[model samples]
Every structure is written in C-alpha cells, then in structure tokens.
Target: MTDTEIRAGIAEVARAHLGYEGELLDDTSLVEALRLDSVRLLTLVAELENHFRVVLEDGDEAGIEHVADLVAVLRRRIG
Candidate 1:
C-alpha cells in the first residue's frame, strides 16, 4: 500500500481506538493531540502491527511520537 493509504489506515485506527475526532493532519502529534497514555499507545502499536503484518522493534518504539511517525514506520514495514 502507498504511504497515503497507510496513513489513512493509521488515522482510522487512531480514531477508533483513541476517540480522536479531529482532523488527522500529517504533522499532528498523537501524544500531544490525542493525549495517548502508555497503555493506549501500546495498544495502538499492537493494532498497527496486526494491520500491517510487521513487528516493530522495541527500540523503534521510542521514535514514534505522532501519527506521522507511525505512518513512516508503517510505510517502511509495508514496503
């Protein structure tokens, strides 16, 4: 899938899982905007991994700070 498609999927997951209704702009910070706590953030990561069929390394988790970061990770995994 393309980056746009991956981003949209991630946004949908965020909306469903985090109750975020605002526009999911590329630069939107998930941590700041969605106010995701540790549990919710881990859930999001697990959901993304399941959806993309890729396992994210534990070290890479630190780099994910926002929807854009998630999208970038998904893009790399999907590709």
Candidate 2:
C-alpha cells in the first residue's frame, strides 16, 4: 500500500480504536499528539498489524516517536 493509504488506515484505526479525532500529520508526535501510553501504543500496533496483515517484530516500535515513523515502519513491513 502507498504511504497515503497507510496513513489513512492509521487515522481510521486511531479514530475507531483510540478515540482520537484530531489530524494526524507526518510530524505529529505519537506521545505528545496522541498521548499514547504503553498499553495504548500496543493496542495501536496490534490493530495496525491486523489491519495491514503484517507481524511487527518485537522492538520494532522502539524509535517510533512520530506518525511518520509508524508509517515508515508499516510501509516497510507491508512491502
């Protein structure tokens, strides 16, 4: 899938699962913007994996500080 599609899926998942209704820009901070705690982050990751049908390895989320980071990770996994 393209980056835009991944991003849209992310937005949809965030809205549907996390109750986040704000804009999700590439530079949007995961911590500051989404306020993702460990559990919430994990939930998002799991949902993303399910949505994209990819298994994200342990520690794959290590340096994901922004939306772009997550998108990049998903793009790599999906590719």
Q: Considering every candidate listed, which one attains the maximal TM-score?
A: 2
> What would the TM-scores of all predictions be?
0.84, 0.93
lDDT of 2 by residue, 1-79 (tens): 8999999999999998899999999999988876788899889988998899999998888898899999999999998
How does residue 26 of candidate 1 score in lDDT?
80
lDDT per residue (tens digit) for residues 1-79 in model 1: 8878888788777788778778777888888877878899788888878777898886776677767777887787777
What lDDT does model 1 reach?
0.79
Q: Write down the lDDT that model 2 would get.
A: 0.90
- Give the distance in Å from residue 7's predicted Cα in candidate 2 to where it truly belongs: 0.5
Best lDDT among the predictions, by candidate number: 2
TM-score of 2: 0.93
Model 2 bad stretches (over 4 Å): none
Which segments of candidate 1 are over 4 A away from where they belong? none
